[model samples]
Target: MNDKNTTQFNHENVKVGEETSPTLLRFFRRKWLGIWQSNPPGMGLFVFGLCIAVIMAIPIVYVIWRSLFAGIDRWQRLLDERIPQLLWNTLSLAGAVTVSTMIIGVSLAWIVIRTDIPGKKAWRWLLAMPLTVPPYVGAVTYIIVFGRSGWARDLWQSTPWLVNALGDYSINIYSFGGVFLVLTMFTYPYVYLIASASLRKMNRNYEEAAYSQGMSTSEVFWKVNLPLLRPAIGAGGILVSLYVLGDFGTIAMLRYVTFTAAIYFQRASFDTASAAVLSLVLILLTVAILWIESKTRRKNKYYQTSNTYRKPLTLKLGKWKPFVLFYVSVVFFVSVILPIGVLVYWSRIGIRMGALDGRFFGFAINSLKVSGFAALLCMLFSMPIIYLKGRYPSLITKVIEKLSYAGYALPGVIVALGFVFIFNNHLPRLYGTFYIVALAFVVRFLPQAMQAGEASLSLISPRIDEAARSLGYPPWKVMLKVILPNMLPGVLAGGALVFVSAIKELPATLMLRPPNFDTLAVRVYFEASESIYHLAAPAALLIVLVSVVPLRYMLKKY
Candidate 1:
């Protein structure tokens, strides 16, 4: 009887051990393998994402590698002379622009979406229209109107009293104040769009709850709406900050010294090593901004737990309607109307002066060719990256998605510099080709493509993929036939964004284009920089017109 009891006890112990072993194995698998090991399909995506990550990382890696080997002499020189001023200039501008955009964007978005101000719908489009005008283009127009030699100055000179009173006190468009104003005007749209969308989608239950608890409208906004809008505001602020950080054209045109302009000058002087070092520092600043945004975003998760959708009630601006209208009008006038009006005025001048010659046609065609190719490539590459990130949730997918945005934050000049090193050393034959310019566009604007693609793909259900597969349609066919049709709108939107961006891109085209290969942007920059406003006006006008294609799409999407 004792022997039988002991044998039974040992059998029970063995059973218990067997039961716990699988749990331990699963824990280890989850800790180590993550999503890649759990789903069989994930392995393939993991490899694909890894490949794309490596490709996307090459430029950043090249910049870092070059910087490290850029001898101590270059580093010391930069530290002593250039880095200090550049750091102060870059950071101050980025900080000021980020804060200003957030204020303007968030305020305008609230007025449009939440207030029953007259013409709210029209205001939405007008507010967003500024995005179509590149900041540098806006700077050019502002310079034409407000610079020392601008219309305002000329007009003041014509008035004896005004001229005497304001002698030598004309607005200087080449100062820090000018850079801040131009950047803010063009970039606030980023914040406005995001905030408007967030406000539109916000579940009113929270606000209602706050109201029921005896909170006033002001209190409700402060206690509930603003907190919920944090993520959207944070995202928009990141974009604006990154834009300010990476801006070369606007700052250069305005004659402000920042890292981007410094890098361009360094590269022009064949100081590639010092340029790399500056680029590395710029990358660090970008990374820090990204990190802060990530932390802020992660601190709160805003989602509706219920599936009920309801439109928010617009607040009646009974007494404040005129004030609100004036505010909206001022923003639109400064950002869109003035710029386009000035361009149109100067374009007519250019036409009269025969500035639209054969070379002008060449510039237009070159712009179309490079922008078209870049847009196509962006749409093509965005597919797989968006597919993996959308259909599969995994560590690898997240990494690739983040890696793809590196270019969006880094200056175009830095990207051009990286390619300069890469092509010169590895593929000397391809160094001066137009294709290199297209590649630079692809790198700089891929994030826009990815954003559009991911938004479209997220609306699709995975069950559809399974159903197609079960119907004996292979993965490729399912993607090509079923997915492509549904994704066409988003793909086109992405392509349009890339096209607009490429057309307006200044630094990359300036740096990478072959000799005598001028795009509209290049010609505009050259003519405008030389103070030949009439000659630059036509190309700048064309760019703004092309940019309008995506504006309608954005109005609908947001």
Candidate 2:
């Protein structure tokens, strides 16, 4: 009887334990929903972010799928002939440009931000103006000045001494060296902006501490400042590397073949399968670069420890002022003055030749219509993704945020190709529409919009969200009523960035636009490619003018 009673007691104990233990669903609910009692992202937000992620991921998925099923013959052809050479050319050029830009960009930023450079306020704007000129436009300008049959060569040939002494020593702007020079000139601004911001916000106390430890100014910079600046440099370098990797127009114009150019040629020849294989390789290369950047960034986390802050100490150039001034002048001259000056000079000639005719108006309208639509779509889509990421800070939201950036990292050519397959195969009805062009723009430039949205959303306190929730506002309503109105400035800034990027986008537009539908970028590209400089000049100038719209925002941001 006693043994039976003990058995019953143990059975009751086991039952009580099972009742108290947490189930998987219950545990997840407590952790996820318990984040904010007043304002948590609902199930709807998660579903929305997932849907966006899937859409953003389509291009990448399509490329991979096509590449894998490209058949053994196509794969072998690329592997045996094209892939080896393209890989070398792409990596070497990307590495060279990245190193060159980092050196120029970091130095120039330090001089402008940290030194007592004369006319810094003007110099800052001047330095950043190069970003207004697309690398292809810059390449075209350089070619006009330095090509074998260029104005520079014509002038030199006229001088007997120059011709005799420097026989066959003319500048060849179509070679690898020329491509490197032009790209570095335009792309260095990426690094400069990032490094400049880091320098501006950096706590000066570390530098002072280093000085007190018997470090010279140079020593302090090398030991204290540079270590802290690594994250900024890495971020900027990744952007430059990606730009170099994905660049088609600059390299193609200069006649140096990379993966982007190779893929374009393959597709032009109707070798779609081969293009997919090449695109997969390029995507892998880009992924490796992104991985390296993330690893480097994770290894270092720089932040100010105290709230007490002071302005950065200005370094006196002293005897080196003239040299610094000369350096700044030369960079500005090469990057900004030369390109715009060439455009203006040629634009006058084009105007005299009546190149800006009725067709020009059509090109302008096409550009505006497409880019405007893209900007609007980007703003619309960016809100939900960024809002979820910024306000909720959950694993799902973080994954969605990362996936959104995948489109931006990809080359425009790859994105365009993916859309060709997707639209032609899946959505055949929407294949040749202008909306396809707009969608391409959205995919290639959406991250810019998301970045701006997140920045704006981050400044609003969660308390505001709680207040809205207390008043019985749903997540969507709160976003519409409270969050968006407060973040309009950032939203506008993002929209402007998207507009500028879309206006300049070339490869995707070239691939995706309907028959006979030419944007300004396409006009400029075709005219320039056919050596019709006079015709290309007007459109190029207009692009530059439109690009200036975002100059103030960029300046403030950096």
Candidate 3:
């Protein structure tokens, strides 16, 4: 009896162990899986997304890493001789331009959106048209009009009265003042577009309340409306400042020496170490400006919570109508009409002189080839990132999203510099190839695609993703089949934006292009530098026309 009972007990124990074994195995698997495995994104999708982010970030990371080992001697030399002057030039220009743009942008937005400006609808789009003209192109026009041998100088010399009044045309187009003016004119549109949108949506309840408290119209504007517009001003100011900081072509064309110009020259001289050092400083400066903007933005948060919101009443300009109209017309003329007119005139002259030759077609083809390829790459690369971020909400996805924007924020020169270091060492096969230029563009503009894709994806319901999964689709497959089809329009719009930007991109293209390869931007920069305005004008006009694609998108968006 004892032997039989002991055998039966052992048999029961074995059965219990078998029953609990699967449970223990599952528990260990769950712990091992953690957040990623528990999520919708499988291991394959996660790895793919991470790889894309790493690739996007390689240029910036490589630049920073190279800068650290640039040697104490190189660092000291740049610090002692080059950096201080570059900082002053860059920061001063950025500051002056940002403040000017904010003032101009906000004032114009207020006039158009709030007051009874004549033909407000016409003025609205007209004022924003300067954005269609790249600042570098605008610089070229200004140089043609105001340079020493330009039309202005010719007119001044011909007219004794004008020469007597202005003292031999004392204004230098290459001076600090000229750069500030050019940047401010072209970039104020950023503030104007955003502020106008903000003004249109702003609840009039605050202004009405201020009036009810016996405040005058001016008082209400000062005490209430201006305070509300801080966010818009900050947003626009940051854009202008960032543009000024990263701007290479305009500054270089105007003969100003900022960090970007310095870095390019350093690299041109094959002093890679000094270039790295300057690039590091520029990166830090960029980080500092961004940090300041973020802190200021966080400290000031304004929200409108009203169940019964009303649009603000338009104030009649009364006796000030003509003055307001004149101001608006002047801005439109200088910003849009003048630049376009200059291009047309010179282009007409050029067309007669065979400016659109076989070489011009080659340049056009080259631009389209590289820019189109880059746009396609951006569209493809951005999908995985936006999908992973939107579908799988986690620390990892958030990081991947941020990493994609690294190139967009840094200067193109720094980006190109990073590419130089990377290709010279690890990517020699791609060095000096047009593929490298396109890749640089992708690194620089992928964020644009991700942004547009995210906006469209937000409108999509997550249940669709779940439904697709229920049909046995994996995460990657679901994004490919369902999400992409839904977001194709936004993706294309983003691609259009990337295409326009890549075409206008000068610094990176100049640095990365292989020998005997030139795009329209490169052509414009070179032709303009050499005063071959006939050749430059045709390309400049083409670029300006291409830039209209983004302006239309901005109008629809803002």
Candidate 4:
């Protein structure tokens, strides 16, 4: 070994390689930087970081320029009038949805992860399956099931007290309360995914230690489990907040306008300038959330970091099993079974009448093709970004890693507006094409692929790639021959998620599609809008079915 290689790493009461003086370390650090400077991958990473900065900054610049040059007067007036109401509505909805999703998701995750819930496998699959069904599809079912012409309304029309609550209660399914209920019901999967992941990975010693102190199960959970689970829970909450901030379909279907819908409205009303101004405000709100997440997410290990790992102790509920089952059943009935049932019933009726609705089918085909292409495209784009971040981590690459957030928090309408502005002006020929729709999908979902890729890459040691290189493999050859196989599972999971999401995307597709183009999500929206839900139901069911298969696989890995 070289004399300098004797530099030491010391542990408690244990001496490792020899310690180095400060001057020697500074020299090595400089040498490392020189090495980084010479490496092609490192330099390529720098260019990638710069490209991400430029791409993300495009909308920010567009929004600011439009607000300054176009919306100066209009924005000033709206800032004084409608802005506060919008803020209250949007933030209040976010708060409520976040809290509610937490309760539902956390509760179920705890039950499955820590308790002897007998049907664990089925429940896991069922809980995750809801993610594939777009919230607007659920909104459609809720409206039909509880609205004026609904079964419950008709059944309760006789009893006076029941009639009062049920009749005047048409549930409108298109109000603030309706938005909250539908969004919360669909989105609990966010919390469920992360929390359950952490819960599954946790070493059992912590819970056992708490119980050894004579604490009851609930006490152990509250005092020990939840606090430890905070980081994972917080990550999920960050995802939920970003998602809710960007959501447009269900909320708009429910007739509630957050920044997303407001932006879409402005665009629809031919007010691209004002829409861009609103997009800036939306970005500001998202940055605030991102800042908060950064402050709170201190670096800490959440994996199985100790040798004490074991299965979590399950709580025996005895008679309380009935209550838990009832609660879970009710949740499933409303969120999953009912909506799916409605779709099945409607679809059967349509089949009997031979009402396939060519337009709806056409839209479904378009949705599948676009989302499929986008999923493939996003995986290709994200692989390089993720690999560079993991192996060549640095401040600039870190910033590029964060740049994905700009798209993450952008509402569909805002994404649509950015493309509308850019493509319409800079590349007119590319305007209103499926490619633009795919690009929007990639922007919205690339972070997902990165997260998965990062985790997958972490499990694989760097030596594998080095070994390949030593064997005369070029860098690209090493990635393809060594890295690709290891990362395939994660890349596929993330791509499946992206595919599921792209199929359900509405506002972006709506604003960006060329005339006569349709996707499954668009078909459901338009068909539902015209009170022709029968034609839309089969497509909605198809979306959910396609999504569930992949979701189960994604959840299983965790």
Structural similarity to truth (TM-score) of each candidate? 0.89, 0.92, 0.94, 0.87
Ranking by lDDT: 3, 2, 1, 4
After superposition, candidate 3 runs with Cα above 4 Å error: 1-37
lDDT (CA) per prediction = 0.88, 0.90, 0.92, 0.79
RMSD of each: 7.4, 5.1, 4.3, 10.0
lDDT of 2 by residue, 84-163 (tens): 99999999999999999999999999999999999997887889888899998898899888888888888888888987
Off by over 4 Å in 4: 1-53, 158-161, 164-170, 299-305, 467-474, 480-482, 485-489
1 or 2, which is superior by lDDT? 2
Give lDDT for model 2. 0.90
In angstroms, the error of model 1 at 67 is: 0.6
Candidate 2 — which pairs collide?
none
Steric collisions counted per model: 0, 0, 0, 3
| Candidate 3, residue 286: lDDT | 91
Model 3's lDDT to the true fold?
A: 0.92
Q: Write the per-residue lDDT of candidate 1 for residues 402-511, one digit (tens) a residue.
A: 78887777889888999999988998999899999998898889999988887888888888888987899755566668887898889888998999989999999998
lDDT of 4 by residue, 1-558 (tens): 554454432242143223445667888878777755644463454565567556755655666677667745887877988678889988999988888888888899988777777797788777876777788899888878876677766666656887666445455666888888888888888898889998887778887888789999779888888887888788778778877888887877778878888888989998888787788788889889888887777654344457667877777878888898888888888888889999999999978877676765677789889999989987877776777777666665677777765676667777778888988999899997899899888877777777777789899999887788789876656666789899998888888888887887889999999877888888888788777878878878888888775576667666
Cα distance off (Å), candidate 3, residue 415: 0.7
Error of 4 at 147 (Å): 1.8
C-alpha lDDT of residue 292 in model 2: 86
